[model samples]
Target: MAPKRMPKVYLVRHGETEWTINGRHTGTTDLPLTANGEAIMLKLGDKAAGPGKLIDPTLIGTVMVSPRLRAKRTFELIFSHSPVKPPMTIDERVREWTYGDYEGFYKHEAVAARKAKGLPSGEGGWDIWVDGCEGGESAQEMTDRADEVVRTVRDAHRKWYEDPERKEGDKGGDVLIVSHGHFSRCFLARWLALPLPAGQLFVLDPGGVCVGQYYHDLGKTALGAMNLGLI
Candidate 1:
């Protein structure tokens, strides 16, 4: 039997949609991936999620996904390549940040609207990390949601490690989260106790993966790899 090892959490961003291709802010809109997007996801599965691939399905303990269609479908495509399906759940917290009034607007359009309203809007103006969406999630709200993700992952790891009966090759330590781009970046920021604005530094591509793990117990979380592209 293979020796037991620390579980690595896999963070996945869903593939492209029309809105994404058009640079629109997508939130609360359950849009399907483009045909090309779906094809690429199937490729991602074959490249990354198998017995000895980068993300071995058998090693994953839990799989959490956004309730949105895009994210859910991404989860399906990736795991479809592997038979060892882990326990999966739908979590609204992993959903994208609500754009509210800015929904469906491109970057330039949103900036223009903010400028017209006399709100900060321009280069380095009206940044989501600072001003947030006028009618949707605030930076603090994103922080709260990210914190919840961190807490959930940490608690799961804690339980897995504390179980006296846990043996080598058991699949209860690694985790997988299929979510949106911005929110997944925010989760990475919060996982390292960084400021929400720092999330901007970690831009995730669509149909990509980020991996993280704990070093000296659940208290110390570490980012192992990120932006491992699939498509």
Candidate 2:
């Protein structure tokens, strides 16, 4: 059996907002939480506090969030009852992608624009990932940023792993991450050392959480459990 101890990452995507429901690329816009979103997060908090085979509330060490208002609000409301509050930090590298000209534009709108512009269709052209809306991020640009964030966090947490006395027989240290949708998917791909394009494989929704477990003996590998939606 695997040891009771291991390092785990609990990922929480912020709750739904009007933009999310509309299929708009929300990137960097600061949208407030919907009432439905708030309720889902409250339930998620209750779930976190309950006992589980692989998760324990007390073992969580840090709560990191994107600086955006949506993520911060979700974290604040969800952990309101925790007596042993961990240190919280905002990381820009983990923030939502800057959508640039694409901000707030709907999917069909962009598709129509692509057809009108007669942009190239493959490898380096107008597909949703590679093509920016005139002046936004190509999927590749976002991937690079996600990779940098994952490495930086992993490196900084080496101390958690280095300490021999820190619960050698439990789920060990954990981090609670609250972030946006698109970049969160990208983060998952990078964490698993998958090709950046592999991010396209994951579909994230509002009020959903994904868990990633890292097995040290197995090397820096990421085991992802995805799309645990609060709804």
TM-score of each: 0.93, 0.84
Model 1, span 30-92: residue lDDT tens:
999999889888989888887777878777777789999999999888778786666568998
CA lDDT of each prediction against the hidden true structure: 0.85, 0.71
- Candidate 2: C-alpha RMSD to true structure equals 3.3
Which pairs of residues clash in candidate 1, taking residues 3 or more apart in a chain or in different chains? Answer: none
List CA RMSD, all candidates: 2.0, 3.3
Best by lDDT: 1
Off by more than 4 A, model 1:
1-4, 229-231
Clashing pairs in 2: 5-170
**Whole-model alpha-carbon lDDT for candidate 1:** 0.85
Q: Give the C-alpha miss distance for residue 5 in model 2, angstroms.
A: 1.6
Candidate 2 stretches with Cα past 4 Å from truth are 1-4, 49-57, 115-118, 121-126, 165-172, 215-220, 229-231
TM-score of 2: 0.84
